[model samples]
Every structure is written in C-alpha cells, then in structure tokens.
Target: MRIATWNVNSVRQRLDHLLGYLGAVAPDVLCLQELKCTDDSFPRQEIEAAGYHCNVHGQKGFNGVAILSRRPVEATAGLPGEPEDTQARFIEARVPDGGGEILVASIYLPNGNPVGTDKYPYKLRFMDRLAAHARQRLAEGATLVLAGDYNVIPDRRDAADPEAWVHDALFLPETRERYRTLVSLGLTDALRATTDHAGVYSFWDYQAGAWQRNKGIRIDHLLLSSRAADRLVDVTIDKDMRAAEKPSDHVPVRIDLR
Candidate 1:
C-alpha cells in the first residue's frame, strides 16, 4: 500500500497542483491538511472525477483536513475526546488494500506561533488528545498511520538551521517533548526509520530564498504504528512539487508498505 501526506496550504488554491500530483504520483491513499475551506467548498467533484473517494472535515476559512483514497473507505471526522476543541484539524478513516484495512488520519497540528500565548497551550493539549487516541488505537491492534504537516520539527536533524528554530513554538523544548511522547507510544516515524540521511526536508518557507537555497525543514511526516510499519518499503518527500507552478510552501511525504 502507498500512503501520502501533503499540506496543500489551501486546497482551492492548490487544486491544480494537487490534481497534477494525483496523476503523477498516484498514492493509494492521500492525506491532506490545511484545506482552509469549508466542506461545501471542497472540490469534491474534481477529486472524485480523478478517481478517489474523499472524506473531508473542513470549516469556512482555516484549519481543515481530509483523507482521499483510491479504494473504498469509511471515515469519521474530528479527534476524539476533545468535544470542546472545534478546530478542523483531524480526520480518521479505515481504508482497505486487499489484505485488510488500515486506520489513517490526516492531521494539521497547531502551528502555535508567538509563544507564551493561548495557542501554545492549545498545541500541547491537542497533542495530548491525539496521543491518547493513538494509544487506544494501538491497543486495538489496528494497522495505523498518522500523517500530515505535524508542525513540529522533532529534532535538529529535521531542521536546516536548528538554532533558528530553537525559540520557536514548533521547536521549543516543551513542544518537542510532546512529540517525543507521541512517538514513545511505539509509533514509527517512517522516514526516520527508513534512512539516517540528513538534509532531507519536506517544507521550505516561501520567503527569504528558502526554497532556492534548499533550506527546508522536515515537519510533514507519515508516522506509522508498528502493526503498519512492519510492512514499510520506502519513504519519499516530493521535493519537486515545491518547484512547481504556484506551489505550496510544503511538499508531499509518501510511504510505501507491503
């Protein structure tokens, strides 16, 4: 099975680029984040015509997520145990691939910029809820994959200039610790598990020649549960998409499994 994740930034704005990718790469399942549009505004017709079934969880102007699968799928929207949390940042589903179904989530983790504000704490709380949910799913013996623009830089190895992000919310000690806690639950950071290579980035800021200089960060990820990771075949970052016409600041990260 091939699963891919990309923060399309704005699905409407990047629809063309996204269609191009669907044709070019053709992942069996594509998890999308940052839709920035309401469910009614999602390009369902275009997507369906391209031959994928989509499950979208979106709000009017910001923070939305979706899961697109080539095969049939059953999906449930939003993160569990956070009824108070209304942000459109999570969507989960079960997609079959001949052998069995795998649980997949398209997540748009909080950016939590401007530290020391309410946003930072929300970010941590969100991670905690997700961690709890992940732990439950793991206990159920599901082949699970949590993929999206995590918005956390994990480690220095994930950032081009680690010092530059040291004080930023995404790389702050507390935030990184929360991410570590998630992985400690036995989720495999698929890309990291597949290779030890450095300088492999999945996102580049549109400002300051970040893409031109190849100064990017590997924030977008496809973390798999052991039940799924055992089938891992390869992991790839579609860096070429960053160079495409009116591209997203981030690129796609894909993982293949048996």
Candidate 2:
C-alpha cells in the first residue's frame, strides 16, 4: 500500500492542486493537515467523486486535519490526553490493507513561533502527549503510520541554512530533543531510513525565493512504528508540487509498504 501526507496549507485555496495530486499520485491512503475549514464546509463531494472516503476533524479558520482513503476507514478525532485542547490538529483512522489494518494519523503539530510566548510551551506539551499516546499504541502492537507536517527540523542537515533557524522555534535544541525522544520510541523516520543524503526537502517558503534557491526543510514526514517499518519499501518527496501555480509552501511525502 502507498500512504502519503501533505499540509496543503488550506484545502479550499488549493483544491485544484490537491485534485491534481490525487490523480497523479493515487496513494492508497492520504493524510491531510491545515485544512482551514469546518467539517461541513469541507469539499467532500469533490473528493468523494475522486474516489476517496473522507474523515475530517475541522475547525473554522485555523487548524484542521483529515484522512482520505481509497478504502473505507474507521476514524477517531482529536489527539488523546488533550481534552481541553480544542484545536482540530489531529485525526486518526483505521485503514484496511490486505487482510489486516494499519493505524494512520494526520497531524499538524503546533508551529510554535516567537519562542518566548505561550505557543512554544503548548507545542512541547503537545509533543509529550503525542509521545505518551504513541507509547501506548505501540505497546498494543499496532502497525502505525504517523504522517503529517511535524513543524520540526529534526536535524541540522534538514535545513538549507541551519544557522538561519537557530533562533526559530522549529529548530531550537529543546524542540529537536523532544523529537528525538519520540523517535527513540521505536518509530522509523521513513525518509532517513531510506537515505542519509542531505538537501532532500519537503517544504519551502513562499517568499524570498526560497524554492528558487532550494532553501527548503524536510518537516513533513511519515514516521512508522516498528511493525509498519518492517513493510517499508520506498519514500519520496513530491518536490514538483512546490512549483505548481498557487502552490502550497509544503509538498507531499509518500511511502510505499509491502
């Protein structure tokens, strides 16, 4: 099966790009983040017409996420251990693959800009909650694929100019340490597992000619649980999507599993 994740930025604004991606890539399962719309306002009709079942967890104008699968899915909204957190940033689903099923999550982790503010703490707390949840799920022996825009630069090599992001929330030492803690829990970063090559990136800024200079970062990712990692075949960043008209700053990252 092929699974892919993309932030899209805003689903309404990039509907055409999304449709084109769906037609071209045709992943068995697709996890989407930053939908920027309500569930009722989601373009379900258009997506369904394209032959995917939609499971959306959406907010009005900020964070939102969804799962689209070629096969029917059973979905759960919201990340566990955060009943007070109302942001629609997470959605998990059970997708059938052959005779078994895999758990897939669409996650738009907090960007946590302006490091001194409350946002950074919230981002760290969210990571803690996510790690706890992942621990429980893995203990249960679930084959899991946590795919999305993590809003993290896991390593210096992930960024074109690492110094430029030294003061940024995404590249701070605390942030990367928490990311490493999560990965230490037996999750294989699909791309790094495939290749150690630098300069491979999944996102570029829309301003300052970032894409033109190849100043990009590999933040969008698919982290697989040990059982799921065992089936991993290939991983690709759909870099061309960044060059499309009205393109999202982020592109898709896809993984193939046997």
Candidate 3:
C-alpha cells in the first residue's frame, strides 16, 4: 500500500493543489497537517467526492490535521497528551492494507520558534508526550506510520547549511535530541532509510529566495514502526510540488509498503 504525508499549510488555500495531488499520486492513504480551519469549514464534500474518506481534527485557523484513505478507516482525533491541550495537531486512523491494517497518524508538531518563549517549552513537553505515546505503541507491535511535518531537522545532512539553522528552534540541539529519542524507539525514518543522498529537502521558506537556491530542509518525515519498516518498499519526497503555483513551504513525502 502507498501511504503519504503532507503539510498543506492551509487546506482552504490549497484545495486545488490537494485535488491535483490526490489525482496524480493516488496513494492508498494520505495524512495531512496544518488544515488551518474548523471541521465545519473543511472541504469534506470535495474530498469525499474524490472517493476518499476524510477524518479531520481541526481548530479555527491554526494547527489542524486530517487523514484521508481510499479504504474505509477507523479514525481517532487528537494526540494523547494533556487533557487541557486544545491544539488540533494530530489525528490517527487505521486503514486496511490487504489482510492487515496499518495505523497512520498525521502530526503538525509545534514549530517552537523564538526559543525563549512559552512556546518552546510547550513544544518540548509535547515531544515528551509524543515520545511516551510512540514508545507504548511500538511496544504493542503495530504496523504504524507516524507521518507529518515534524518541524525538526533530524541531522546536519537534513539541512542545506546546518550552520544556518543552529539558532532556529527546529535545529536546536535539544530539539534534535528529542527527535532522536523518538526515532530511537524502533521507528525508521523512511526517506532517509531508503536514500543516502544528501541535500534532499521537504520544506523551503517562502521568503528569501530559498527554493530558488535549493536552500531547504527535510523536516517533514514518515516514521515507520519496526513491523511497517519490514515491509518498506521505498520512499520519496515530492519536491517538485513546492515549485507549483502558490505552493506551501512544505511538500509531500510518501512511502510504499509491500
């Protein structure tokens, strides 16, 4: 089965791009981040009409997620964390792949910019919660795909110039360590695992001629559990999508499982 993740930036602003991607990619399952709209305002009809089921975890105008599957899915909204946490940044669903089912989640991990603020602490705490949950799920022996815009550059090779991002929240030492801790729990970074090439990136800034210079980073990732990794066929980052009209700063990443 083919599973994909993409941070559309804003679903409302990229409906056409979404449709075009669905038509072109035809992935069995698609996990999306940053829907940037309420559930009621989501273009469910449009997506559903295209023959996919849409399970949305949405906030008013920030941090939202959705999972779309060509097959019937059992969906659960929200990441398991602080009960008072209201950010709509995670959504999980089970989609059938032949005789078995794969658990897929879309996550828009907090960007955690300007490290001195409350946001940075919140971001770190969220990673703690996510790591705990991931560890538990991995122990349960599920074939899983925790896919999304992680808002992290896992290694120096993931960025065009590592030095340029050292002060950024996404590349901070603590943040990378947290990400490493999460992946250390038997989760495979699908794209990196499949390809050893450097300079492959999934996000480019909308400002400062970043894309034009190929100055981008690989923050969007598809992390697969051991069971899922065993079936890994390949992975790809749709970098060309970023060059399309009115693109998101991010692009799509896909994984194929046998």
Candidate 4:
C-alpha cells in the first residue's frame, strides 16, 4: 500500500492543488498536517467525493490534521500527547488493508522558532510525550506509521546550511537529541531508510527567497515502526508540488509498503 504525508499549510487555500495531487498520486492512505481549518469548515464532502474517507481533527486557524483512506478507517483517536495540551496536532486511525491493519497518524509538531524560550521548552516536552506514546504504540506490535510535519531538522545534512541554524529551535542540540530518542525506539525514518542522498528536502520557506535558492529543509517525514519498516518498499518527495501555483511551503512525501 502507498502511504503519504503532506502539510498543506492551509486547507482552503490549497484545495485545488491538494485535489490534483491526490488524484495523481492515489495513495492508499494520506495523512495531512496544518489543515488550518475548523471541523465544521473542513471540506469533507469535496475530499469524500474524490473516493477517500476523511477523518479530521481540526481547529480554528493553526494546527489541524486529517487522515484520508481508500480502505475502511476505524478506531479513531485524537491527541496522543495530552488533553491538557489541547492542540489539534494529532489524529490516529486504524486502516484495514487487505489482511492486516495499519495504524496511521497525522501530526503537526510544534515549530518552536527561538531556541531559549518557553515555546522551545514546550516543544521539547511535546517531543517527550510523543516519544512515550510512540513507545507504547510500538509495544502494541501493530504496523504503526506516523507521518507529518515534525518541524525538526534531524541532522545537519537535513538543512541547507547547518551553521545557519545553530541557535534555531529546530536545530538545537537538545531538540535533535529528543528527536533522536524518539527514533531510537525502533521507529524507522522511512525516507532515510531508503536512500542516503543529501539536498533532498520536503519544506522551503516562502520568505527570504528560500525556495528560489533551494534553501530547503527536511522537516516533514514519514516514520515507520519496525514491523512497518520491514515492509517499506520505496519513499519519495514530491518536490514538483512546491513549484505549483499558490503552493504550500511544504510538499508531499510518500512511502510504499508491501
């Protein structure tokens, strides 16, 4: 099955591009981030009419997520982090594909910009929570696949210039360490698991001529559990989406699992 993730930036603004990509890719499961819409305002009918079931966890105008599936989606759950945290950053569902089940989740992890700040602390704490929850999911022995915009540059090679982001939250040592702790729990970075190329990226900033210069970052990712990783066939980044009219800063990343 083909599974994918994308941070659309805004659901309403990129609806046409999103529809086009979905039609072109035809992934079995699609996890979305940064929907930036409310539950009532989500274009469920439009997505459903395209022949995929939409399970959405949306908020006002910031972080929101959704899972679209060609197969039956069941056992939906929201907020693997905490109820007190109360951010529409996570949504998980059980997708029935042929003989087995796939636990699919869409996540919009916190983008803490400044390094020494309250938001940075929150980001670390959030990662801690996510790590704990992911470990629990790993213990369940299910084929778990978590996909979305993590807002983290996992390594120096993930960014265009490592020294440029020395003090940025996403590239801070603590942040990278926390992210590493999560991945160490038997979760596979599906893209890196497939290839070892540098300069391959998923996100580029609209400001400061980032896209024009190819100053991009690999913040968006599809992480697979050990069982799921064993089935990973191929992974790709749809860089062409970034060149579309009224494009999102982030594009799509897909993984083929068999």
Best by lDDT: 2
What TM-scores do the predictions have?
A: 0.98, 0.99, 0.98, 0.97
Where model 2 places Cα greater than 4 Å from the true spot, the runs are none
- Worst 10-residue stretch by lDDT in candidate 3? 94-103
Q: Give the TM-score of candidate 1.
A: 0.98
Q: For residues 173-226, write the lDDT of model 1, one tens digit per residue.
A: 998999999999999999999888889999999999999998898899888999
Misplaced by over 4 Å in model 3 are none
Segments of candidate 4 deviating more than 4 angstroms: none
Task: Give one digit per residue, the lDDT tens place, for model 3 in 32-59.
Answer: 9999999999999999989899999998
TM-score of 3: 0.98
Quote the lDDT for 133 in model 4.
Answer: 85
Query: What local lDDT does model 4 show for residue 152?
Result: 89
Q: Summarize candidate 2's per-residue lDDT along 1-258 as a digit string, tens digits.
A: 999999998999999999989999999999999999999999999999999999999999989999999999999999988789999999999998778899999999999988999999999999999999999989998999999999999998999999999999999999999999999999999999999998999999988999999999989989999989999999989999999998999999999999
Clashing pairs in 1: none
lDDT per residue for candidate 4 within 1-258, as digits (tens), equals: 999999999998999998898899999988999999998999989898888888888989889999988866884646555667877888898988678788988988898876666888888888898888899988988789989999889988898887888888888888889989989999999989988888989999999989989999999988899889999989989999999998999999999988
Candidate 3, residue 223: Cα displacement in angstroms equals: 0.6
Candidate 1 segments whose C-alpha is farther than 4 A from its true place: none
TM-score: the better of candidates 1 and 2:
2
